[model samples]
Target: MNASRHLLPVLVLLLVTQWAAAQINDTLPAVVEPQVDNNRVKFTSQLRPLRGVAGAPAPFYTYFWEFGDGTYSFEKEPVHLYKDTGDYPVRLWATNNYDDGKKPPTRLKKIKVEKKTMLAANTPPAFFKGGGSLEMITNQMPRPGEDMVLLLGYRNKPGSHTATVSGSVMLLYNEKQFGQNSFDLAEARSYHQEKKIGLDSLLAYAPAEEWNMPLQGTLTGEADSRGGGLFTASGGGNLPIAGKPQLKAFLKEQMEGYRQHHIWRINEVKQGEEQFMFLSLNTLPEMIKDTNAVVTISGLFIPDDPSMDVERFALDLQIVASHDPNRIMLKNRRLNYRFTGKNRENIYKVQFQNTGKGPAKRVAITVTIPGMLNTGTVELVDMKPACTWCDSAYANQSCIDTILTKDSIQFIFKNIYLPGTQQEGISDPDSTMGYVRYKLRFTKKMKKMPFTSRASIVFDKNEPIYTNRSVGRFKKGLSPGIIIGYNTIPGKKPQDILPQNYVLGFTLSEYAAYKKYFQWEIYLEKSRSYESYDGRRIGGDTMINGVGYKVEYRDQYRQQKVLSLEAVPVHFRYNINSYMAAGAGALVGVDVERSVTPVVETWIQRPNGQGLALMKGAYEKQLESFANWRGAFFADFQLGIVRAGPAAGIRFLQYINPSHQRIFLYASWKL
Candidate 1:
């Protein structure tokens, strides 16, 4: 019974242990609660409440803060100063320890700090009108990058106007800013007043840095009309002015609108003798009427002493027409004239008017005649009535003398003229007809004479010449002539190549009675030759008789060879006056038996050779047939006439083999 009781205790212990293990493995329910607002933390507050768990304790705690001046702070609840004027952020955190036995204890809530509010003073100063100048006072000159406070005082009639007035203060600077405590203004000042403001003090932060000082307030106040006051003071530095000559020149050249009426002059000289100048721009309409003027000071004048720098001072003036009242009239009246003549002596007359509103003075005229004159002489003449003040005369009889006046000026010219020419008779004909040209210019001041007008003229002559000629010959007639010639075949054995023999031919012309050194000819010729080559001697006579026509064009001559297909044993000949010619024709000749025997008997004994020998023999027999057709093509070069009367040439002849489909050289002409 005691053992049984012990066993029950052991069973109960096991059950308890198993239950504990089950409880350890089980998960706790998730907490459902509101979270803390981390952005709502207030300044001066100690602890912040976080959201996400209402009944649960804080799980974790953290802090954060933001100052309006581009800075941040992190703490449960942070306190910080905004070094400058701006907004700031505040944050916080909460810690909580959860007691669930199944999981680890964790801090769960996080909160945010709220943005802080700041107060700003935007009120302006009140203005007062009085006889005395209103003074603005400050504790010290404004530092380079710091704000300054200004005390503005205004005085007026008692109860004459409202005592309270409001305005804004503006800060002007030469540079920009970075953060609240950082800026680029090296020197700064303060200014304030009812009617005027001035630089109170000059504060320098760093020598290399720049500063932006502010003008304080939109100053407002009432002022008595009798005692109204105004004050002026210098800023950190003097205002910029045009001090350099290059800058002045650039301004004068580029600033067209202000150039005409503005004049810059040296008004005074300083202790070092440096000239001080000021610019005066005319604002009146009449001063700049119809004139666009620019004056640039190119140089300066110093007192002329060896020791002093001052000397003769002069400004270069470049005057340009800016506005033209008669622009349309001038554009419409613009004229260009062209004069053409056969000779340089031909007079060219041109008349031109201003056709504009401006007057032309000291006009000049010049004449240039081309040197290509057949006769090497020329003269110029002016055709105007004689005047006492302006008269010019030419000594040459061909030239005329006259005077120039305001109304009109006439120019006359005379000279012997020549032009480029060709060969006298054969190729060209000569003639003389050329051109003259002129131009005029006007000057206000001349080095030799004042208020004079001048003109410039250029004349060139071109004479025409014929480049070719045309002639006529008798149209129809006939003439005959004989030519005796010898022919030799080309290559080693010249004597064996051809029987050295003579050739006789006849020539005919279109005219019979009009025989002269120069003549046109159409002819027919008949010739014969005997030729041989190698050890085989073959002689056959050939006759060539054909009618041909020729035409002489320029330096070149062309002739066509005419042949009748029915004419057998004849070769056609075509000749150009040049050394070379090309021809195509046919030749008919009977093969003549020579003293050499047939060589086919040497190969007749073999079984297959007999058939080959018979075929060769047949070929030889067919080649001997007189009725076989033979075509010839040739290119020939005339070397010279042999022994004077008969012409000879080297000809390359391609004769078609009737039996074998091959080309062979049948003959060649040798002088």
Candidate 2:
């Protein structure tokens, strides 16, 4: 009877196991499908990128999306835009780990995009062209007797009739004026050139004539209307000349006078060695402000022609810049910085401005103050800088600090924005308000005598502007200088890089030799407070792994006020240029530290167990010995007054780590 009972229990257990196996098999299929937001075709009239949305459910599943255009996405909800116009098939594959982790059946979608075109059937053809002062592509300023290239833009209605076009260009300055016709002697010359005629002899024989300068002048012109039938078959092109001979031949004397002062010319681009057909253009003398150049063109059509003229307009521009004195201005408000000795409160402000008609972009302002190292003589502007004539007109207002070129301070501001006329009372005077201000002091003498300062403004889009100089004469004088700086250590303990956090130091230097000599004599450093070599906690409370307990590391050192002395055996330098210097020399030093107890410390919670901060117990250890007397192969480079490179030394109780030798990178100063 006992054996039968045991057999019955075993049979039941076997049956239960079989049923559980069957249930697992039924749920193992793991069939999942991927979906998306938009699967319908759409049309756009532009050749721009397109974006699609994926609406796939996930979390337990990994998604992979294949965009038809050779791009793929692994995101659960992928979004893509096609920059090209075409038909693309997108597919998605999703896999979940619940089963064998194999990709499920792919989800495919089809999308079609329409072709893109720049012109629509309903929109008329347009033209956009001109020169400086005019919004066009040429980045140039015209010079006296220079041939000014006038840009021509053209586009016509697709089904326009053929037509003939001409233009009349004129330079009008009050009573003084110059004008030209489409079919003039210049045009005849171009016509002769097409037949391979050499006009060198004719041109040389041309008499020299004086140019008339009007008190007030204006420039005017146009093009699309001057488009001949040639543009209708394709598109319009730029022409140098565009005028008709309308004034009667009886006015030949006046025309001759105008022709003598101003002439028409043609410019051509070349492919390989083949020169392109000459494009009609105009030549003008470098006229000053109040003078304007004018142009006018017309499009004429005949019945039954496939192309016709449909526009007419005029272009006029007033010349404002001059070849002699460009529009940039500079001045130093402090005038001449007079000093009695090697040191002085060399304080001043420099102002720069763009007085031209256009905004200056990518302006590089360089201020050269020879004989000054940024580290010593240059102090932080102290507080927020004062601006007498600026209100966010310029972006990137920060200075480049010590620019290495010629001991100069340089920085570049992008897009010096000019307010439009619509902007309130800011007229020409208000425009002069943008200038740079710097305040500094010089405590040490320079390698050369007589301090001379000058500034320059460079532009990426225009000619550079220069400032007049301020020269300072030396008097038998002297004054003190101050400098504060920082350097950081990388290690398991005290991982801080703040100037105050790493080092607090003071250095005094003197100009001992001729005007060509200077040396750093005294240096003092104070160690900053830091947690023990461990970071888990600071002060009385610290951290422990996997536990809610506290431990603390304390800051300690013996005779912490460490001092050092340096001598200048042979001081020399290699000049890379008028603006940069490189130098190296042997320096030996002895660390001064009084005998005292050196300790490592920690803290623990008190027996009262009140609060971590309320009660504490302190622990410390005294070291057996510490090494001293250290120095290394040191190299120094001066970019103007800015310095860089590595160094080595020793501190009391702790020999300066050779690895930490780079701290000198933050230790140089000129004053």
Per-model TM-score versus the true fold? 0.16, 0.20
Q: Output the TM-score of candidate 2.
A: 0.20
Model 2 RMSD vs true structure: 32.4
lDDT agreement of model 2 with the native: 0.34
- Candidate 1 displacement at residue 564 in angstroms: 12
lDDT of each: 0.25, 0.34
For 553-624, candidate 2 gives per-residue lDDT tens digits of 454434333344433344354545434555555444454442334444455554358554332333443322
Which digits, one per residue and each the tens of the lDDT, describe model 1 over residues 466-564? Answer: 111111112233433443344343454645544323334343422222112122211122222222222322222222254221211111111212121
> What ranges in model 2 sit over 4 Å off?
1-343, 372-406, 419-428, 443-448, 476-671
